[model samples]
Target: MSQLNKNNLLPLESPKVLWAVAISFLCIWFYMLGARTLVPTDEGRYAEMAREMLATGDWITLRLNGIKYFEKPPLQNWMNALTFAAFGLGDWQARLWTGLCGLIGVFSVAYTGRRLFGARTGTIAAIVLGSSFYWAGMGHVNSLDMGLSGMLAITMCGLLLGQDESASPAARRNAMLICWAGMALATMSKGLIGFVLPGAVLVIYTLVTRDWRLWARLYFGRGLILFFAITAPWFILIALRNPEHPHFFFIHEHFQRFTSDVHHRSGVWYYFFPFLILGIVPWIGLLVQGMWTGVKEQQKGFKPLLMLLIWAVFFFFFFSISHSKLPGYILPIFPALALMIAVYLESAKPNALKLAAGLLGLLGVVGLFSVNKIAHMGKDAIDIPLYANAAPWIAAASAIALAGALVAWFFAGREKVGKDIAILSLAFGGFLAGQVAFLGHNPFGQYIAGTAHVAAINAELTSPTTPIYAVGRYEQALPFYLQRTVTLVEFPDEMEFGLQQQPELWIPTRAGFVKKWLAHQANHEHAVAIVRTDIFEEFQKQHVPMRVIGQDPRRVIIATPVPSQ
Candidate 1:
């Protein structure tokens, strides 16, 4: 044992269990502060549905834009709707429940790490999991990612702990029975992919390791009974109430989404290389070093270490081979990797860590640079101050983490390099905060407020219940902002859906509106706002008339029908 090992931080062999609990609480508190901080992303859509459910008093069907939106399960909406009912339609209120779910992931990893490895391994594992962009990014948002991730981590942790003793009746219950329950929650969170990938990984792992004996731990009779008790009730209730849901959800949504490119989320073969490289963040160096060291020393005997390397690699290739891809698809494997990295670091020689920390610190700087450049492109594209809002905090955090690197360099010979890096985890935390500060969600009621602005300008012409039709297409964000339903026009068959609907608003390309009007639709629709911008001049060149009632870089509101009393 090293000098630091002799002066153990905790009397227990592992401190990670306690550290994990502490970190989970801290992360929750941090996120809880600005539940209303940024606007929701995909979160807004879910939140709005919750709002609609409350508005219309229909909870089971889950509607968006007043249309049936059953693509995603209603777990998030249920949570958000309950929050909104309790606390009002506030952003944080809706997000708070889901954020708590994310904290479950942190707790799962920390506790599981300690249970599977030891205190040092547990702490590093929790930190690695916490530092991951996957969960943390999901943490502050109102999305299914965190909930799905939480259930996954819990189930995996149970499975890991189950490896300890198949014969123990209690362990069997917690590990197999309870683990299956967590799998059910994951399925509820995002359909069946929740249980599917992890189940697949476990089967493959058991096969390769020749560990069918682990199956004995499952206690098939008790396990099956408990699994149905926990998971089946909800499926039965939902499927019976919404009968068509079974065919659409089971066959079309899950199977088709994975096996085909139907969703069109397809990316190149190596889509995740960049995402993973950035997703690990400030600790990319340590993670890389940890993975490398873990792989090289696998013959030295780290079961979780060996298992995770195989797990992450298998899922990576598995999803890459699949027809559909999204950045969040790889989330399940991260907790295992984090734990593995933690274990590898805990087992590393004292002198080796300094070089590792320095390399990681440098890698963080490189990641920041890449993200900054891409953000600039986003800034140009969105014409908003997105990158501008994000750069300073990111740059500063990188600089500080690098300084911590220097500190680690000087203290490399010390036995507590793992401890030092944990302390430095907050520097990475700062980058996340900075990123949030910049890209902070517009909080509901913020964006497309051009919608509200336009409504105000045309309020005399319309009302709280006005019949306004949107020609061509519309942004759903705008309608939510305006609190109105819009009518969409079809192809050249305008006389049917178009003239009959006769929308007051025409949010279409200048070319489409011009073609429709010129075809004897009406001379009245001649004066258009975007027409000047798209037809006569680029959006940047056009100066809108009628009124400069409200302005954002994305929109310019103007009065349409002069005014009515």
Candidate 2:
């Protein structure tokens, strides 16, 4: 009987619930702020591709590495290109659209939750998940994750709202239209996977639940026209213009990239489970607990719970089975997870809530403690970096610890406070993760930008024709950061096929082509010398006309072709 009060979610005027949501939103907004530059993980490529679009004024073809890039569609790049047009090719501008899309996603999640559950669940879920590390981190990034997440949420909302039995015909039609448009935008954001995956899930859910009639009423006649109307022109334009792109992008780049090791992103199955946990850290316990409770409550017929379970399970396995893997691939499921958890917290038993608080607190404490140990880790001695905001992260550590204790106390009185604490704690977890990883010195700091040595090399050896070769392999970031052509030395086949150009001078990999280069040195009459692939190699140690540079630990640099001085 006491659980009855717990079941009745907090009233709209509840100060605790309001504060929890407000705090969560503020934290998420702050966490994602000022992180609008192209980082190594595809940001540089995306930004650069947009830059190329702006430079050539060719909206029809999307090229990366100087070759026709047919992998994904062009809406994101077009949005990014527009940003570039408005603000030049600046990193901040190029990435602004991504952040904006993230904001849209956050808003969609909140709106969807509110409609499906209640104000308390909607606002809290929005706030908590708004501050989520995965969302925050990917939000500001110039990648497809944030945009896809935004479109996915909008589509899910439309689908869910369309399912409302009492909705007016106009409302249902609006939702169906949004669903189609969202699918179109989502496909534009990534590739076919965006529509295929979501479509598969929705179809399966409707089939299992015996709601297939929803499709007929989706107004596909009009919705399909609108979808193609919005999403088609670009595909028609790009495909017609690039000629060989549609097949290459659809089949080889998008499909084969998933089914093959071509991108070298293969991983053991279940890898994303850990990433999913970490991705929504601080919220992991709450999310899992909510999911577990939702599953248990299936007998009671919680439609939202079942929907999210299916949503998460489908995306999890679909990408997990694919040969390609990336951290952002699973972002679409988080909003569903967030709403599900929020709904459960709003509706779970007090004892269950008590268990949730303990789990969330315990998990947060462990995370804070682990970060404490990592804080003292030395930099330069290794790849680890503790930057300017290290102090802030450390400062938040105690607060995080306090949040755990607060969780325990919240449940001691009004059990409604359990959901409030649960939601707020998840936000704090997201804030902490974003602060630790991106703001300052962390292992990620190194990957975020090219080495200053590269900049110094740029300053020294930079001429209109200095010929910057990326010693052996390739990092697409080189072109965007350096604003020059970076030739890959060994992957000549890829360079020819992708980049469609060659370098003036070849900086051979010392280890890979030692004998071949040595024989070349012997056969050549010109004054020739070989350099090692390290920062401190003989000719590369002291800064000359050029110097070696690196983006990460594994990649190295060695300069060559002193330009016939």
Candidate 3:
């Protein structure tokens, strides 16, 4: 009965209850992995790269739409390509790598939390991470950041577990090696920052905590060998195959992208703060409490909480000062934040927990009322309908959150039931709510994906040999849907580097595209082109003979007449 007096996170104490919750949460988590359309830029781009890899059977030289693409490393692409090999190409297969990474972060943090702190803290940490809005949401999306973050979590957790004095000598060596390997995999996932950022954090940790002895535990000799073993092969192979790759990938992509606004992704210093807040979702109220707990924590031995604090703060400032900033860039700090928050949640006062629950409920209510505003969020008239279509999902997500928060609030102070139920309700609620909102986004995602026109475009094709061209524009998602590469005309966009390497892959001018289209017509060969609406209109005014097979607000699919029979 005394156990009932504990906080709202009761299920953590019971093995049966914890397993039951884990199974249910995982089912929903995996189900949503394949539930949505692959959106542009990230989702479609990565998925198509993997598709091309699988199609072409070239593993080392990564290509996008049949052009050399070297914007990042190949770990995620390799995993995604492997996933496609096993499961076949689809939304879920593309996202499986990221989804697994998210799970890896959750479980690793949980295990680390259990090892460094206690069982309760570890269990709560997993709950906090698995449900956090950014982590949970990004996990389901096919993106590189989650993959990096997940591996980074393993590195951080391994460091924490390996450094603890209680660990046996063999355990310590093994954990440290895991830490090194994690960093290497993370580097392969994104870039050098995987190991660089962790190294910087370790340096700072050593200086701040003055734990000079901690350096000896790094196992650098074995670790460096392991790191290179994981990350070096592809770098060596790709550079050997494409000489231009070394300069562009190493210097231009990493250095120029960080120090200058070359990518046009510059953001103000505080840009990530808002994302961090919203990303934590229902846990927003406890962020301060968690940080405060970390700041005030002081121990004689290895300071795990302090290490976490430094990890989070260093990353926040590092990216804040970078010339390029995206919301996902700050993801590496979340695992540390989860561990800090779990420590706070373990011994939090009932009244404080109640207050946080109340605030979460209020947030849900606010979201419910503001959901209608989604209709106005669209920048274009066509997108307005899609945004409106997603409003109901927002409302449903909000209601679920509100319901969970209320239950949590009620159970916060209940001695008979304990706080376990309360925490579980809110965490599950946040996870489900985020998933619902993501599901709601499919209507707009589909519009952006141009999948609605894939069938129409396919029907116009006389055979698989029908030539397709993208004129004055690129539809990132369409290539994956069509399962074939299109000839690019008068546009390079992100594929400029790839185009530069192989100039024959695309037409450089509209005049050239027009000439090619005419030649195809003269040869009586059926060919399709996805033209920007304005370009299509311009071609129409120029008396270009083509049949409109399919069109959306953004683009028009024009096809040449079939061969004379």
For candidate 2, the per-residue lDDT at 240 reads 74
Q: After superposition, which runs of candidate 1 have C-alpha atoms over 4 Å from their true positions?
A: 1-7, 10-29, 32-41, 237-243, 288-303, 350-352, 363-389, 417-463, 467-565
> On lDDT, who's better, 1 or 3?
3
Better of 2 and 3 by TM-score: 3
Give me the overall lDDT of model 1.
0.59
Flag regions of model 2 displaced more than 4 Å. 1-31, 35-37, 89-91, 292-305, 351-354, 367-412, 415-422, 441-443, 461-466, 492-496, 500-565
The TM-score, computed over Cα atoms with residue i paired to residue i, of candidate 2 is 0.81
lDDT of 1 at 319: 80
Write model 2 residue lDDT over 312-424, tens digit each, in one string: 88888898999989888898888888777777666666555455446556655665566556566646634434432364565465356447446544643454544455445
List where candidate 3 sits over 4 angstroms from the true fold: 1-10, 375-381, 562-565
Clashes (N, CA, C under 3 Å) per candidate: 10, 4, 6
Model 2 CA lDDT for position 7: 68
Worst lDDT run of 10 residues, candidate 2, spans 523-532
Q: Which candidate wins on lDDT?
A: 3
- Per-candidate RMSD vs. true structure? 6.3, 5.8, 2.1
> For residues 21-109, what per-residue lDDT tens digits would candidate 1 score against the true structure?
46664765565535443243465566677788878887776666565555677777778888878888665775676677767877788
The candidate maximizing TM-score is 3
